[model samples]
Target: MSIEIPGYRSGTWVLDPAHSEVTFSVRHMMISKVRGTFGVKEATLIAPENPLEAKVEAKVDVSSIDTKDEGRDAHLRSADFFDVENHPVMTFTSTGTRVQNGDFLVDGDLTIRGITKPVTFEFDFGGFGKDPQGNYKAGASATAVIDREEFGLTWNAALETGGVLVGKEVTIGLDLQGALQV
Candidate 1:
């Protein structure tokens, strides 16, 4: 079955940074998971004349990486991890877009710590509505799994029980909200 998304016109859609979030989770200590969020510096969606050709681009501030603990946050910002001082921003640019079985497959280039790789995320059109301020808003949720090592984030410690302190696989989640350009 096919359902048409609402308020998605052939025009630019500006991301609402205050309402959208990019978060991630990864296995920790081979037992549980650790989650965090990155601050989006900017994000925009250019609706192509052909709906399937839409492009989404975004920049995230590495310095805003937050996992709750200040000490761990500092370590993540250091060279051993994100090296936020040297690489302050990470970016993503969509190469292709398509609707499949009522969902969107956004194939894109993800750049992190100066390394770029192709990745695809499956997105669901959550809903569309008017915000409190009367702006027409579109909402979506996306998920993708990526290897930390692929992004040059291979730092880890050997666990006494046999695994590693951090898991190589990271699950990315995006709860996105955007408004149509007037």
Candidate 2:
């Protein structure tokens, strides 16, 4: 006996930012975790037959970062961090993908403040289904560790208690939904 499996087809999928989010959390002086999210961003995935062959790209507007604190958010967009005026956009382009035990590891180049570095995220496939309006949708989530200093976000202060402010490792999370076009 022989068996066959259905494969993904060629199409351009648009990310539903309204339902998707790019969020992060970083330790503050090894004490508390500071969490924030980027609001204005978009991503596209082109998966043709094989998810590994997909081309993924994402663009995030620096000024759209929000931590729910006006003062901190403003400062983050200033010269110390994202520097929204000079580098308004941060982007990511996938280099390749690997699947293991029903999960994916996507390796990509992330560009921030004119600096480009490779990063890989462990992705969870959220199953494929069609919406009520007949739109095909697929969901995925990924997480990765990043160094803020690598992106030139080195601004910090020494805490009166003991340690220096901010942490070296930043955790990034992505919850994405893509609309497949056949």
Candidate 3:
């Protein structure tokens, strides 16, 4: 069966930062996962009929990385990790998209700490819905993994227990919802 996504016009659709966020998590000392979220400052999505032709541009405020713990969050914003002062924004742009078994695989360039790397995330299509005002909305969720060292966020400490303080692999989750303008 073919699913019809409400057609979007050929224009820029600004991401609703109020409802969107870029979050990540990593294994700490190989026993627990430490999670944090980055506030999205801006995003522009140009979705065409062909998923492969769809493009997304997003910018995240590095200074907004929050994990609820003041000390940990501060360290994440420092030079050892994100270095918010030097690299204030992390950005991403779609390169391609593919469908496998009815789900989307979105390939894109993810830039962090001045380093850009290609990453792919599996996406789930959330059907179009409408608000009380009759504005159409569509949503999707995706997840991908990244190497923190590859992005120059290589701060780590050796734990007496054996493993390092933080794991190299960082998992990212994206939950996006946008308004349709057709």
Candidate 4:
């Protein structure tokens, strides 16, 4: 079976930052998870008649990384992690879409800190509707796991017990809402 979004229309959709978010989490201290969110600078969706033919491009503000802790946030902006100074924005450009065993997948190139890698995100359609302001809206969510080391984010500390300070694998989640361009 193929994926379908009822009431879907072909057009350009601009991301509503107020209604969208990009979040991530990674193992911390070898025992717990550290979660954070990055501000979405901009994103666009070019929807085609067939959902599988749709295209998406997004830009995230790396300097806007927040984990609720100022110190850690600062460190993340430094050369160790995101290195926001050198690369202020991370981008994703969709390459194609496909279905696997009834699941929707979006294949894209994710660029972080100057490193670009191919990644596949499992996507879920949240349907379309008219918002309270009388604007056409579309919603969707996607998730993917990536290795930080592959993106040049290799900073870590050796734990006294046996593991490392931070986990290498990072899970990224996107809850996106967009307004159809008139």
Best by TM-score, which number?
4
lDDT of each: 0.88, 0.85, 0.83, 0.94
Per-model C-alpha RMSD? 2.0, 3.0, 2.3, 1.2
Clashes of each: 0, 0, 0, 0
Candidate 1 C-alpha error for residue 149, in Å? 0.4
lDDT of 1 by residue, 1-182 (tens): 23345656678889989988999999999899999999888899998657687889999999999999899889989998898988999999999887777667999999999999999999988887888888878889999999989999989999788999999999999999899888
Better of 3 and 4 by TM-score: 4
Which clashing pairs does model 2 show?
none
**Model 2 TM-score (2 dp):** 0.92
Q: Please provide, for model 3 over 1-182, each residue's C-alpha lDDT reduced to its tens digit, 9 standing for 90 to 100.
A: 22345553444556767777788899988999999898988887886555467788889998998999999988998999999999999999999777778777888999999999999898876656776888777677789999989999889999987989999999999888777665
Error of 2 at 78 (Å): 0.3
Whole-model alpha-carbon lDDT for candidate 1 = 0.88
Backbone clash total, candidate 4: 0
The TM-score, computed over Cα atoms with residue i paired to residue i, of candidate 1 is 0.93
Give one digit per residue, the lDDT tens place, for model 4 in 35-149: 9999999999898888788898999999999999999999999998998989999999999999998788999999999999999999888999998889999899999999999
The sequence of per-residue lDDT tens digits that candidate 2 reaches over residues 1-182 is 11112434468999988889899999978889999999637888887666577789999878989898999999999998889999999999999887767556889999989899999999876767889998888877899999989988899898899888899899999988888876
* Model 1: CA > 4 A from native: 1-4
Candidate 2 local distance difference test against the native: 0.85
Please tell me which predicted candidate would have the highest lDDT against the true structure.
4
**How would you order the candidates by lDDT, starting with the best?**
4, 1, 2, 3
